[model samples]
Target chain A: MKIKLCLQKSTPRKYLFHFIADDRAWIDLLLSKVALIFVSIIILAALYHLAADAGRMNHDRQLDLIAQDFCSAINSAGKSSYETAGGNIYFFDAYNKYGNFGSGINASVSGEYVSVSFEENGRRYGSVKPLMYKTLPLSEDEVRGELMGAFSANGNISQPIPAFYGYTAVTEFLAALGTKEENLNTSMEVHIEKTLIYIHNLNGTEVKELEYILVHQ
Target chain B: MSTSLFISDEKAFMEPHNDIISTAMIVIGFVIFAAILSKTYLTYDDNSLSLENYRQAALIANDVVGYPAIQGSRQDLISAYALDSITMPAADREMHSDFFQRFSSNADFFVDVRTDDGSHAWIIDRYEASSHDGDIIAASVPVVIELGNNARCVPGTVTVRLRKNKWI
Candidate 1:
């Protein structure tokens, strides 16, 4: 009975082995191809994210440098204007220096700070530096009109306003004497002026005051 | 029979064991990559911060050297008389307050002016020993010191040291 069982099992086992051997190669190849594709996709996705993060970091560093440079320029111009007979004019080319990489770039000086901001990949990045000189606050419309008038007088209005030189109506040039614009790519003129203003004292006497005026041209 | 049973059991155990080992290897690789990336980022950040601090110190030094209040007959020239008056112990309080008013309120720094010969030296700000506890960034610029009314000018150096306070 044992010999009979062995003979019957051996015949079926040989056929089963042949059948499995025929199919196993195809199945293994298919599975390995699928796994390779999945791993490649994961690696590519990770690389893309790392590249994006590095780009963002680079943008932030550039923005910080622009802010520092603007502050240093303001300080130097203010110091020179304080001593010189006539005020100083500093030409800051934001777009050329730091705005080339990011979009919706804006620079402004409000109160005691000079700030630069931009947008990248649906995220906003900004940097600010403190100014050593004092500034007087003024309204946006007033500053815009003054800047327009100055540019017009200098024959700079013959060419169309550069894309980066102007801002939308809703955006306010909040800095009293600083420039404010969105999508900025043009150069800006910072005019530091030492002017005299008279104020009425509590005793009704006229007090002469020396004031530093910063204006965007 | 025992050998066949052991072989079948080994086949079942090896699959899950291999999977766990591969998964652990992937996790370890990711952890190492992340650690290296973070360390590189931190080092870059530290270097940039140091550069920024030095730049700030340099700006302050230049501004102090060109300040009109301390300037002599010409610009970029330090007046000996003014330095002498301001450095006096009796005038320290008023001078310190004046310097605070002159520079940005955010700046925590002091200025040092000294001749090349070490004959004269002056500290423009009220400096305390405690201020040295924090990280200090310093910058210096060449300047001309006016000794007297006879137009005797001596080369000097103006140094600005900025203190960076660490947040807890």
Candidate 2:
């Protein structure tokens, strides 16, 4: 009876051990798959953050261009007339002549300073100037169209898109921020003191004109 | 009996298609890896900070050139800025002070004024070179020249140089 019991114990247990050994490859495979999934998620999350940073940079770049253009127009006006209050300043120096700077801006000159502002959500965004604010009645596109027609009428279609998107401004800020695009309204303004420039104007002294540019998008 | 057990074990090992799932996972992981690599590698910088500085310099140049020189509280028309101010800076201490105040900042700023013929040149600004390498943004804008008087307008160049910051 002792010999029979020993043989039974050794031989029967072999089947159970062999079953577990056979599944080792499958267990490794399952664990490897799960690890791969976890690693992929981590890498993807990191990439998402990088892409979002790039998007914010792009938005900032756009705003920078608009601000530069507005200041440039004002500088140009300062060269000739300090009496420039009402004019097509959005296309001043052809900064936004392409109508790319979306609408919601207003510009005008009051007293001795140039005034520019942008409106979003029924709220005006700008500095506290001495004069009251009034939203411009025209959009950037409309202003551009009118200017284009005027230029074309004079047989001078020299207006060209000023290499604004040389490399296609890559911006995914709204996407990365998981924010709605319609809610963001960007506006920028610049104020430059007009200098008194006396040129060949007989005996009349002339001061540089103030220019104001506003963009709403 | 041992031979029979070994045969059954080999059959069990081959029963599941484990290799298929492993290959699929590796392929998917590799694709994702490539995508992340491309996004990181194919980056193009669009930082126009230098250009913006140039534009800013140009704007300031306009103000400097357009500034009219006068006596008796700006009521009198007199040419204050001319080729002489470059040589005799003491001629307009107040004017120079005002300009220095306008363009003062943490950055190194310089205003090199000269004629188109390169005849007269002078610098009026606040600039100090840091102890390390840095980015320098400069712009040369034409000023409205005043022909007869120092406060008049004409065409001249106002070169502006601004060293932004030290690069690490």
Candidate 3:
């Protein structure tokens, strides 16, 4: 009985240390799918934001066209042009001109919410009441103050000028613009590249006061 | 060396390792997918400055032309601005201290009115802006003013130019 010198173990400790590279649990698969869905959503959201930006840019361009036309029309307003009104409907002329602002888009005159002060007899930043002169021949400064008072609104009122000037086309477009409804969402703007004062008093003498020259000429 | 040693008796195992192939496929696939998706999605840049100033210029021009000069005393001509009154005969104290108040703004603006013929005519009925060096700001609208008396209303095409200051 010089029996068994070579013996082998049925289970080896080293084998337990071997890792199966291809094996994956079900939870791993589920997590991967969830992650994929989240990533997909993020990508799609980014794409959507890009598209919305383009749409917004295009809309603004269209508005610019309509607004420019409106400006021209308003600036050229004559004595009879019913600008800022199409038979009393506000922004009517503009609405009709651009084929009703290209469907679903409405042309409107929107106002701003401003915390304003009403003092100095409505000659400062008060309610834009009419600059009524019970007496004639007021000081130029007084008159200027009266008008500037209205222009001194808290927000920009330039947006409505082009439409008002374009649509009404009044003879004196500036002179015709009175009343709250007319001035709403609009402001009186003056850019003085040059100023001319004509003395037609006794002699037809024209005097001009030239301010600083513009860079662009 | 013996021939048996150089040439194996068993068939040569030519198939690639499945684990290695699978791992490579997953990594490459994920990379390709991510690249394509990113290319398709990410695209947003700022482009509001130019157009915005353009609109601002338009508003400023409108303000200059449409500013109300007088108040309630004359309803027949209550809310009239100097630009509009310029079309009429020269009046006394037409625009006073309020000139500074009305035109004062954070953004500097320049405005001028000229006839189509390029002669700075219409001295009696014109308002000119003071400056013109800014980005994307300037609006020139064509206007026709009826000068003289109603019996002799002369039609004139005037160009009103408005510009924002460069500093603004």
Specify the highest-TM-score model's number: 1
Chain B TM-score, all predictions listed? 0.73, 0.49, 0.41
Which stretches in model 1 have alpha-carbon errors above 4 Å? A1-49, A85-103, A120-122, A137-190, A193-217, B1-19, B72-77, B88-100, B115-120, B126-130, B144-156, B165-168
Name the lDDT of candidate 1.
0.61
TM-score of each: 0.59, 0.41, 0.30
Ranking by DockQ: 1, 2, 3
Question: Compared with the true structure, what per-residue lDDT tens digits does model 2 show for residues A59-93?
Answer: 44444445455545544543443354334323422
lDDT of 1 by residue, B46-141 (tens): 887778778778877876786666889998689987787666352545444444443444567777789999998987665444344468889999
Model 3 per-residue lDDT at A56: 51
User: Clashing residue pairs in candidate 1, if any?
Assistant: A164-A184, A164-A185
The count of residue-pair clashes in candidate 1 stands at: 2
| Local lDDT at B109 for model 2 | 55
Native-referenced Cα lDDT, model 3: 0.33
- Summarize candidate 2's per-residue lDDT along B1-168 as a digit string, tens digits: 988886776545644445556656766776787677656544532145555556555655555554554221242221324434432344555444433432223225566666666655666654333232356676776653444433444345767666663330
Model 3, residue A61: C-alpha shift (Å): 3.3
Better of 1 and 2 by DockQ: 1
- lDDT tens readout by residue for model 3, A61-99: 455554444332322221111223221112423435545
Q: After superposition on all CA atoms, what RMSD does each candidate show versus the true structure?
A: 11.8, 16.2, 17.3
Ten-residue stretch with the least lDDT total in model 3 chain A: A208-217
Which residue segments of model 3 deviate by more than 4 Å? A1-22, A25-28, A48-57, A76-97, A100-179, A183-217, B1-107, B110-168
